[model samples]
Target: MEFLAVVMLAVFTAGYLVLAGADIGVGMLLPWLGRDQDERRLVIASFAPFFLGNEVWLVSAAGIVAGAFPGLEHTLIEGLYPLVVMLLAGWVMRDMGLWLRGRVDAPRWRGWCDGAIVAGSWALALAWASVLGSLLVSAMSGGTGLNAGTVLGLPLAALFAWHGAGFARWRLPEDLAARAARVPVRYAVSGAVLVAVAVAAGSGLSWSDAAAEGSALSMTAVTTAAVLPLLMAAQGLVWWTFRGRVESPSYL
Candidate 1:
């Protein structure tokens, strides 16, 4: 039952990573991909449908950790208190930017909000990556994992950028969408290389390690290793199904 709970938690975490990661990635790329107000609106509208709902998985994951693995939760919170605060602050700032962008007419004000959106998204991505990297390092070494996590910020940022590009390709239109289509391949390849390096640099724990131990950590690791790929595959299929030019909405 504990193993099952851990596995369920991993599933929620994977969902958050795919869904919310893409949302954040979209925010991160708004300034880069959006040349004008209409283009920027399209980029923002792409994920607007599910943006708030997607965060449920993050909350679910955190709740599971606090409920099921209280000790781990305590440790993680203590070690990453600043990051946790920053993550929350970033989200709040980004949300404000998203909402205010539509309301404001002043070019200078909109530009400032746009910059905030990107900065907030970048901060969130980097903080999340650092936390995961630290946890992975600590999991392997049975010690504090702060430094390695900080080091992993770049690749993860690139990975999220790739994610956003994939989304733009699926949801944007015309030359904008075509341009987005070209972005993912480059970032995906580079991000994959960096991730490979990170994995290789670590202690290289395997499925066998999970199977041998039958512990909570092992269950989480095994579940994540098995499930994340599947989630990503499904995300790709959804994108493919929705690919090509964005259709005009009935309201529009």
Candidate 2:
């Protein structure tokens, strides 16, 4: 059960890093990827279909931590409270921008929305990097200073941007794709590498000691086993449905 819980947690976390990373990266590079409003819309349309679905992975990972590894959850929440708050704030801001951008159809409103998307995306990336950096540092050095891990935040954020550029090259239209491809990296390869590194760094943590026991572990393991297949199936369906290059703006 403990092993199952750890595997599930790793799977969900890696899934989010690889899947939602593209969404956040694209949003982070929206201004560069899309020079004008129409272009921006097209760029956004590229990843819109997958963003919400990708978020499910993050939620599942969180649920796993809370249910199957309550000790780790408490430690993270206590140690990384500020970063968590930043993550939530950025998530809300980015989603609000995406959901509201098309509603007004006004230049000013859209501009604000665009700014929100960019800012929120950046915030999310930085916060995630900081959290990961902190964890990596703690695991490596046996220390718990929040500022110690922040040194890696900028570099990790750059990795996120690179990952986004790769995604853009694959999803955008010909002209935009050409622009995005200038970054010179393969999307799948970079994403895989990113996920691998994150998982490896996380593997250094003391998960066995932090995991829940007894009923809590059993319940979480069972629940994860039941839901994971459905989640993967749904994700596959969505990806298949929108596999083609996005030619125009989406409802986003």
Candidate 3:
């Protein structure tokens, strides 16, 4: 049960890193990828169909932690409280930007929304990197400082931008795709690396020590395992339905 819980957490974390990372990356590079308001709308359109769905993986990962590995959840939250707060704030900001961007028709309103999107995306990427860095350091060494996070955060954020560019290459039209092409890395490769990093981080953790006891662990693991397939199916449906490249602005 402990092993199953750990695996499920890793799966959801990796899934979020690979799937949502693309959109987050795109959001980070919104200004460059979109340029004009119309172009920005196009760039937003590219990943708009999938962002909300992608976010579900993050929520699921959190659920797994809180339910199956309550000790780890408490540890991570306590140790990484600031980063966690930043992550949630960035998430709310980005989602608000996406949701409100189309609600108003004025250029200024749209511009502010775009700025929110970009800033929030960058914040999310940096916060995740810092969190991962802290975890890696704590796992490998016995340190709890932000030094590793500070050192690792920028590079990981850059990787996020690169990953977004790769996604843009596939999702955007020719001109915007060309703009995204500046990154020079394939989306699949970058995404795979992101997933690998997440896996490595999870593997380094002491899950056996951190998991819930007895029935709590078993029930949470079983429930998550049962629900995962349904979540995957729903995700698959969304991806398949919107697989085609965006030709115009979406409702975002």
lDDT scores of the candidates, listed in order = 0.66, 0.87, 0.86
lDDT of 1 by residue, 189-231 (tens): 4334434544433333222222323365555545655766775
Expressed as tens digits, the lDDT of each residue in 106-223 for candidate 3 is 9999999999999999999999888877767676775444556545655677778889999999999987899888778898899898987777666666777788887988998999
Where model 3 places Cα greater than 4 Å from the true spot, the runs are 143-147
* TM-score of candidate 2 on Cα atoms, chains taken together: 0.96
Off by over 4 Å in 1: 184-252
What lDDT is reached at residue 246 by model 1?
63
TM-score of each: 0.73, 0.96, 0.96
Worst 10 residues of 2 by lDDT: 143-152
For each predicted model, how many residue pairs clash, with residues at least 3 apart or on different chains? 0, 0, 0
Q: Which stretches of candidate 2 lie over 4 Å from their true place?
A: 143-147
